[model samples]
Target: MRDEYYGRLLVQRYQLLEIAGKGSMGQVYQAKDTLLGGVIVAVNFLSRSKMNQRVRDRFMREATISALLGEKSIHIVKVRDYGVDEEEMPFYVMEYLKGDSLKEAMQNQPMPLPKFFSFMRQICLGLQCAHDGIEIDGNVTQVVHRDIKPSNIIIIKDATLGELVKVLDFGIALLKSDESPTGFMGTPAYCSPEQMDGKALDNRADIYSLGIMMFQMLTAELPLKPKTSSFDGWFQSHHYQKPKLFSEVRAKLDLPQALMDIVNRCMAKTAEQRPNSVTEVLKVLEQIEQNSAPLTTQSQSYTANTPPTVEAICLQSIWPKDKPRAEIVFPQLIQYRETEIATMWIMLSRSDIEKYRNNKPHSQFLFVGSPHPMLLWLTTLYQDEQQHRMLPCYLDLKKPIGEKILQILNQTGSYRLILFALEGDERCVCTIEGKVPTRKMQLLKEWLLESQNTGANHGQIKESKRSLKEELDTLKPKLVASLQRQISKKH
Candidate 1:
């Protein structure tokens, strides 16, 4: 088996060095891309004997989808090239990633809370991007990674983000809009109740699998144990048995009740009981992080009656003054500062800052990235119990506005909403930020697709702008209500 592909060249480009691994999809080889100065890469080929159309279609789709997703999110493994061999076998070259599989890292031990939070968030971000769906033909089809388990996640070292996690193997990912028949596909130990029943699956099914991974990550044990390792045994376990409580696993397991609740909700027998989207789950995660913030020296100094000054709130002491103030960038925590918490920094004149503090400000976040790569990041920070301060910055990918948003985000870590603000002026009285759980980016993507499909001859650009205006009109009230709710909640 090893000798078969030992020194073989694929597509007259990739020189196979050795067999790396093998799966149901095909064999993966550690190879060198001859066209790229002999750079190391992983080349995966379809099973040689069985060149059936079904397997070929699935393999090609996996490669295409993985490549498309990798372009959008850093967490998904990137596919570089695809080709067919002389024997009509399909193969794809991917970036060779060297890391320990999450399963290997688990090693029957619970992951530390901090690491678990960081890694799980990265995993969810990847899943969320997939579930957000990709444009296929004229439709946006949600990709359900039917197989989500510890083994499919790779953790590698990074200079900025530390342990960078990448989700691997999209061979069995299901496009919900695809009418093709797919058999029961998932690791039995981590399959959702719906998946085991051969029912049509959705993001919830992946969420279910994610729950099992979460349980294992926290406790190093499966929540529901099958009587045997067989399919039927696991089916019975997933369908009939309840997930074991944290206390049931270990008497003194130090874990947050909130974290436990999230895991349990994900593993719920019915998908309806689970969190509807990853954003919902992320909201809870934000709460957890905020709750876990240790009281810092600065925090101890400030009282509820006396708020921190604009200088302190803006992190002026350690702010990146070299970077342009109007430019949008990734949100960076004040890690070196005494107060280690998530905050947005902005520079404003003393008078403007004072005026902003006096009045309640609104905020809004707008993103249009399909037809154009642009993001209108905005925010309003509660200055006190009675008022708010507005911050806004627009980012265009084509210009300097977008430079650091994605690059810095990738270097640092997972998906985080970077809040930005403009220098106060007479016209800066109003601002807005998204508060609704709705997927704004998804809607924009679909509208962009529709506009593009309209073609230039049909006034495509104008049509898109009009439709977008209509959508914004409808969305504004919901967003305003969301902002008001935030204000009320604080009061």
Candidate 2:
């Protein structure tokens, strides 16, 4: 049946253009809707030879679910028509999307933070609409998209939203009132614990899958890594294993603590522990976006006897005269690999700080420092709300601070502030009010250079390696408890 229908007209309305894609279930064709001004559309046809009763039923169900969902949500692919051809094989038409699948987009690297968030928010919106229940014959029936993985999510270019998200494939979606077969149905990597157990499910199952998608988008990796290739092993891991913390997996990425917390909740082992609804997830995402600051780059130069600028003003509020004040300047521009750090620093500067001796507080400061993992970790932990009350400054720790910088630091009053410093083999967190000694500055530069050399080669390797056996062992107790609960329910 391969390419048998090419260049043929279906119902004298749709002209098969070319083979768009092929899956285990059916072959999709890029077609032109002759009746509708020749608009491009996708037509999926079930193979006549392979079309058994069960296959036909599933194909129709997919069409029905997609049609119902498309009417309610823009994020869903719109179904334009459904019918059978002259051979009596069933087919459905959908709006053709000119974009790549999420799986394709993430094949090479993880998406940028802003783009990732935008895509996620749209996905949640579509899921929420589906979970809200579709109306049929005056009754509302809940729809659970059992299969929500990257491959099923399409990213299209939109005039307004730039990158628009469209969720695809509802072949296995379950209607709450429908008495369908309760079998394990979903991609193993994205399946929720309950879904893996073949237990009753709801929209929360989809949320779990979405969580896995988020994890992958952020790190270009899955949270759960099954030791064996067997389906049973993967199922058990999803059911019993605890997902690795995002912070631990991508420590240098500088993700917001709040966003990570939301993802964590979404992937909770128990459905009850996850957000009650997709709407709730959307709300959290909105809050994070609203509070997040934009990342920007600025280049400035300072000379001796220059008047105190905003950076100097903010430094006065952060450093106290009674304590040793120090500024570390790196000779080269230290690249902050994580976009979250730049946003965090921006938010920190906007926060309010008590003025010293009637002097105005500064909101911006040059960051000069070595790229230490500890510093990155600490910065990531700084929440959005805390940004309003603290003055944060950025400095390059690799370069020597000139006399003008020392004058500005010494001018500030005594205050408790955080100075991320590295001493010999240890990373130290200290609060100082007086000027830093020249000798100490020299030592920090040497440490920064040495750390950079070693980190360039070993940083990623160290972070990526984990003991799979230990991870599986920790999940043993949880697996036992879950099995016991299932047994008790049967009794």
lDDT of each: 0.68, 0.61
lDDT digits (tens) for residues 98-211 of candidate 1: 889999999899888767877877788788889999888888889999899999999977432456788999999999986753768889999998899888888999989999
Task: Give the clash total for candidate 1.
Answer: 11
Clashes of each: 11, 31
Q: Best candidate, TM-score-wise?
A: 1
Give the number of the best model, judged by lDDT: 1
The lDDT, on a scale of 0 to 1, for candidate 2 is 0.61
RMSD vs true structure, all candidates: 12.7, 24.7
Off by over 4 Å in 2: 295-491
